[model samples]
Target: MTHRALLAATAIALAGTTAAFADAHTDSPFSITTIEYGERYLASTLIGESVHVADTEIMPGVALAAGTVDEWDDIGEIGDLIVGVDGTLQAVVLDIGGFLGIGERQVAIDWSALRPVYEEDNLEEYFLGLNVTQEQLEAAPELERTDADG
Candidate 1:
């Protein structure tokens, strides 16, 4: 085949490939265009993973914050959840209390609610400010409540 003809064929193939890529991009109806740490990592993947919340000026007691963070704190393994408070992901919840590591507290916050922490050279994990309180956790429905009521 002639060089010009070969080049023309190659250009046509490239155009077709580009169009295919464009089509694929539009086909992704569930594609995540925006980033949401809470929904992407904590809400889905971190359900069974250890959650960590570091001790910092913002979050002095990790347990208090964790208990007050979510409504599902009555069940599950929470020790695996490590929440960094001052490093990067600030205001994140990290519960560290329970029986035989079976009753760890639940801590969760929307990604949009976290305070943006500046990534530092010495920083390790991300931290954020949590909207939690000790009273809220204690007020949670206990496991014995339903049993006792019946």
Candidate 2:
């Protein structure tokens, strides 16, 4: 075969192979209607809820001004969240016994013990109630640290 004709045939073969590979990975054939429904339902049910630890109210990433509730003025900000084995929110981890971010400990408070403050039908705030105080929080058990290797 002529050199030009041979080169043209090789080029066509390469193009066909490349097109086939591209077609295989392009898009999925399955429909995502159920996924969309689940996402919307979960978001509506779980989002927009707020949690109050001591005098501070929190909504995930948003942190409001820290204040004192009566004489319990030593409560620190929330550091993490604790979930139960049943996939429900169990407690809020609060940073306590610290001074200027030093010598702090995280302690868990019962989720049910937190007073849910609402506005209209939506959850707007939370209160730890008078039962909890800064002194008690400082004396509470410290959270155990776990390594990622576990």
Candidate 3:
């Protein structure tokens, strides 16, 4: 399949897919409230989560001709998330570069670039994948947010 087609398929598969996390609230603080699966994602838990490079064979104009999707080469980790006023996810600032607290810089990536990898209706063992490369990520501009920006 083409890259766009694969992204569409991934989106369709990921839509409404949820995961159950140990919540701290007695009244289900982060519950999505579905009778079938009852899954919810905690925003706080998403930080520091790793994002890997997804399938590249399907992608056109990419530097790599072939790639192992199963390998899931980690590109970066989530540092912060930008949310719109309407409660929509705008972008995710990823902490790229450096190792063990050395030279990490936050790069804001578009929310659409992330693809959730999971089984049918099962997000228990899923991970976030990106259709980008580590080199690209390293070369991207850093995202600096000021007090007025918020």
Candidate with top TM-score is 3
Model 3 TM-score on a 0 to 1 scale: 0.59
Worst 10 residues of 3 by lDDT: 57-66
Candidate No. with top lDDT: 3
- Candidate 2 residue 59 Cα shift, in angstroms, is 20
For model 1, the superposed segments whose C-alpha errors exceed 4 Å read 1-26, 33-45, 48-96, 102-124, 142-150
The whole-model C-alpha lDDT of candidate 3 against the native structure comes to 0.67
Which regions of candidate 3 deviate over 4 angstroms? 1-40, 55-70, 119-123
> What tens digits encode model 3's per-residue C-alpha lDDT throughout 1-150?
999999999887666352222232346556655532223446676688887875452332222213344477777689888999998889988887778858878889887777655544443454667876667776889897899977
lDDT score for residue 99 of model 1: 70
Model 3 / residue 53 / CA error / Å: 1.3
Colliding pairs, model 3: none
* C-alpha RMSD of each candidate structure in angstroms: 13.0, 13.5, 18.1
Model 1, 9-46: lDDT tens digits are 99999999999999978876776677655234444554
Any runs in candidate 2 off by more than 4 Å, and if so which?
1-74, 116-130
